[model samples]
Target: MDNLSQYIDWFRHSSSYINAHRKKVFVVLLTGETIAHENFSHIVHDITLLHSLGVKLVLVHGARPQINAALSGAGQELRYHKGLRITDTDSLQIIKQTIGAMAIDIEAQFSMGLANSPMHGADIKVSRGNFITARPLGIIEGVDYALTGVVRKVNAEAILQHLDKNSIVLVSNLGYSPTGEVFNLSAEDVATEVAMAMQAEKLILFVPQRGVMGKDGQLISTLSPVQADLLLKELAQDESVARNITLESLSAAVKASNKNVHRCHLISFADNGALIQELFTREGNGTLVSKDNFEWLRQATINDVGGILELIAPLEAAGILVHRSRELLEAEIDYFKVIEMEGMIIACAAIYPLDEESGEIACIAIHKNYQESGRGDHLMRALEKEARKQGLTKVIVLTTQTAHWFMERGFEPIAISDLPAKKQQMYNYQRKSKAFIKTLR
Candidate 1:
């Protein structure tokens, strides 16, 4: 396909995301390194596009690298305790100057409006103020952190008012005390606190790398809060890993997830258009820390045969699924996985290895009451995950009544002859089920 054709197709596919994000609140974090990178302009453009699409944005920026540079240039000693910067009187002054300058630069970037550029004709409004209230860290281990502080509260009402007026609220790492004292706060902490206070739909952190990587050197695309906590503990044991940015980013994601922020995304700031790609595309280009733990998907055992039967009985009676006896289900229980909610099986699917490189998915059924709530898609993903664990490269499904559903999910129609040899032989000639195949990545 030509570039224009691909762009047209992508635009068509992104319509759903566009509608979903409209009018939703998002809190975005930009670190000092991110703003200094060449791709900063592109990131700013994407943020502009999102604002144009009716997304209310709260931008929290950090000046860690810039502050460090300024302090070093000033012939000052840098001190840190337990991964938190120890900001003395002089360091606090330098931090305020550095953060002040960075915030102005970011606002200026948002004010760009050059013809022929992405921001052309986009008269965006940016608002910044003392939106965060902070308290001092006091002392730990008999050492005073001085001006280093933590977020005590966020002025969410003021931020929302600015958003209602169609302005993007810009926040800095500097917070103020009721006593009129300025305190240096961690950018990640500020971002998390703001997200929780605002109850944002998403808390997006622009990091240096693509996303969180496992010990195997591969990016983990999605994680639950429990899983993220486990990964955090595992990453903390390795002293070679930089604990400042990456760990803090992941830790912030976890904190937001636990505090009613539904989703937290960590994407690379160096990659141009990553913010747009992650938000608008189905296969997001980053790690998604989501709080979707209401239902559990697990491999089925013999004890779950009754629940599976109960869940699929209606489908079987309606000629949508092949009926299986309890004996047969118990025997093949190891090949099944189920979605259970509150000790009840709401969905179930089975993957049977038909060849060395292919698996057949069957008996996919969801409770009628839960059919419209994405349980089917959840079960399908579980089946695909099981197929990958078995080293299968392809998955086939035979559907007499749900061919359209499978086709909509990336499966393509195929003739019976295209099925694996064993599956072809076992195909019920009377049922005349249509075959569809999908190649796994």
Candidate 2:
């Protein structure tokens, strides 16, 4: 009953804690559903906010309604046997046009908007590449699926190459085979295939209603594939999951999770800023499917500093963290935090106040043994805590490297002028560093 608005507020509270403590890359899947213009506008606004936050979005749009309209306009009746759309030649042609128009409309909307509409307020930098390889679905349940195809392969390299350029990758649920025939693939299937192949950090599917809700009217924030399967089994008998497309989208998510894609989320096309609420917040807007715990955020403390220093000292000596003397560290002892597991520190970061509502994150270091295991991320979040307790407005980091890691965690690189006087002075001294800032409020 609280709705996504409550979740967005919760996310804001948790950000100060998460940003200071963790550092890592994340991906999200945004599955599109045709909805009323007002709801579409709301969804667009949500996407804009997420885009503004520099969150990576992989958009997979569905044009079932558009396809239906095209089919009807072309004097063809739309039909589905079981869950599969009955597509003949006419249907396939309509699908291609409908999907192309939908992609253009999405681009147009993104182009028109200030944030979510375009990439970083420049041109329409989002890319819609040729990544899918298709194969005919043939027949299932004694019905011929015909030219209807399933995704056989995705060009993950091409997609990543485009994403690395800060461009959104738009996927049409239609693909072409080597034989030169077009096949209409399920939108859900396309989104999942790309996400799984790319090993996306997060996958999100958007639907008409507020996302996956319990019978009691509460949001199901997170669910594993097994749990979702059980829920779906009951819904199969009960009609409880509301929209059927949501079920389709979720089914795709479950399958994606079983593969390498670790996290997936479903959000409402009905709410404004829902994507931002889900991506930037702790407990997101919709139901999340993953193989692991998503509560991967927490607070950091002084006790975490010693081990954190151990991780950082090597990097510091190597000229990564600016050489700060032990006396200086003792003087700023309250600024450090570390990731602890079984009473051992594996990673660390430090936070220093920039202003009443802002701070500076520094000295991020991960032990080589635990380099990619998320320990460094744990420490970055700790730094976020120190800033929040001080009522900071934002946190900045100066890194000679690690831009990609910080970007994933929602930090934006800026010029030295963006920093406060004290931090700027320090930043200028460390001429080799690149500056990044994450808004705290």
Candidate 3:
């Protein structure tokens, strides 16, 4: 019992690697089918948490359900064509109001952040634009689109300028065509166009039910575009694919990736901190799609730092990783675990025992060339196993970069004094060096 107590205590108290990496900017598509009050709260929490990170976010919201509800309440019937909504004259009017509610509701919720965690932080910039250009789908199989439209082009440079100035640009799926005609676009289309134009690091779509699965509320962590294309083929053949939000979203993501967006992520609005989970954790609370399965983690040996250093040099040069002298790595030689593919170490992490029963992971990183594979999670699980072997029950981390990551893995934050004595003595709380902890019990 004493041993168990000691183990649990250690698991709760060890610190995390705080200064691991720099902010990886991303554009997020926030859309959903369920428009309940509960979801509104989650939107607020997600924004506040991501804003806490230096992440540059562009929020695009979906309000089709809201618009439908409003229109229906006014005794108007909804129109559709080939699973796409037919936004005629009346629907167009409701779209503006429905989208306005989403933007306004989110803005009001942002103001509710804790005073210390203020909504109006120096980096907290949120704005919405009327910048979606659209063209009528013309006629599909003899069905006229009416006022329904497809996104023709996005003024992504405008959004990027706002992003460079540290603002969150909110987009509503409405646009005006070049011919002086107004049209409505799918939220998914709007997100994809913006991602392509920005050539974003990541493009994420937040939808309901996690991923494209029949199971209730399941989240798929990884998929390549080819795999997604095949699954979408199956979905297209079967109408029973009612829950396949993943496939529904793949069209735009594939287009964006083909246009040079590095990655695409589809997450649930249901997960409490889905945004953070997808962004920071190695195993995301969402489905990540890329052209291929890229490897980012490997088993580490004391000798791999030279190889690891080669991988991180660019990040250091980019001012993402704090430069360290060779002696510093040698002094903490036993702490690294690396990822190897083709017999070459591509990623590494530095893990150490904070005390007799406590472990701390530091300098956790992936080779940029090998990122987006599930290798990071594999490395973390290996680290967890090593901690268990050493009889440490608690693990803590200091992360200026991955707070949402640690949080998703069940790590919570407390004051530095909450750590075990030896670990606390090592704490270096920089503006970017936030803290986290996880238990093994």
Candidate 4:
């Protein structure tokens, strides 16, 4: 396709995301290293695009690298105890200077308006203030953290006021105490606290690469809070694994997910379009950490077999789903994923890979009580992600009554001959299930 055609197609698909993200609160955390990277400008432009689309953005920035640089220049040694910085009086001054300078630089970048530039005519108002309250870490194991502190509270009301007025709230990794003292804070903590306080839709953290990769060297695209915690434990115990993981960003993502932030994203700061790609596409470019229970979706297990049977029994009796024996379900349990609510499986779906580039989406069933709420769509999308991970480029569904629904979600009618030879042979003529195929990009 030509560049123009590709652009048009991208914009067409991105329209849904544009509509979905409007007025949604997104807390984006940028590390000092990210700000200093060459890709920072591209990230800023994407952020401006989001702002233009009416997203309420809160940018939390860190100055760790800048502070270390300043301290080194001033001949001051950096001290740390158990990964917590020991900020003395002299180092505190450097921290403040570094943070203030980086904040000013960020504001300057956002303020840019040049002809023929991405920022042209993009009038983005940035609001920055001491919206975070903190208390000193004080004494820990006979070690006084001095000016280093943890986030005690976030002034969400003030931040929301700025957001309500269409201004991007800028928060640095520095907090003010009630005693009129300033302390160095962790940017991840600040972002997490702000997200929780405001109940933001997402807490996006910038990492050095795509996202959390598994031992197999592939990106783990999605993770529940429980999964993230387990991964953290593994990383902590294994030195070789720890080298490949960004412990801090993953920790924050897990925390935000657990605290009901709805979604937390770990995106690569070095990738110019990671943010946009993650937010606006069906298969996001980062790792998403979400809750595992009632409000989330996850892989099915042997324990979920009973719930799956209960969920599909109604559909099976109505002839909407093919009946599966308990033995079969147990044997193929790993092929399914379900959405549970209060200990009940409300929806379930499974995908069986037929070939290197094709799969069959089957056993899709949603509870009668939740038909119109888009649960089916959720299951389909989850299956698509799974299909992609399996190296499948296309997914086909055999349905007797849900053809129209699948078609609405971009599946197209296809003849049975188009399916894999084995699948075609297995097709029962009496049931006469319609075949629908969807190509994954």
Task: Pick the lDDT winner.
Answer: 1
TM-score of each: 0.68, 0.59, 0.59, 0.67
Candidate 2, 1-441: lDDT as tens digits:
587888777766866744532322234434444443466765665565555455566777777766777889999987787767878987787787777777787887777635544334545466886789999988887889887789999998888777667777788888889987888888888888888777777677776666776778778888876677667766555543346767776787778776656777788776777766676667767788875752233345555555556667888787767777656766786666655544556556678777666778877776664466455666766677667767776988888868889999999989888677887765555356888889875
Off by over 4 Å in 4: 238-245, 292-441
Instruction: Write the residue-wise lDDT of candidate 4 on 346-396 in tens digits.
Output: 789999888778999999988775565567888989999999999999999
Clashing pairs in 4: none
- For model 2, the stretches where C-alpha displacement exceeds 4 angstroms are 1-37, 113-122, 238-241, 294-441
Each prediction's RMSD to truth: 16.2, 15.5, 18.4, 15.6
* Tens digits of per-residue lDDT for model 3, 137-172: 888899898888888888877887787776778887
Q: lDDT of candidate 4?
A: 0.88
| lDDT tens readout by residue for model 1, 73-96 | 999998999878899999888898
- Deviation of model 1 at 380, angstroms: 32
Q: If ranked by lDDT, best first, what sequence of candidates would result?
A: 1, 4, 2, 3
- Local lDDT at 311 for model 4: 87
- TM-score-wise, the better of 2 and 4 is 4
TM-score of 1: 0.68
Evaluate model 4: give its TM-score.
0.67
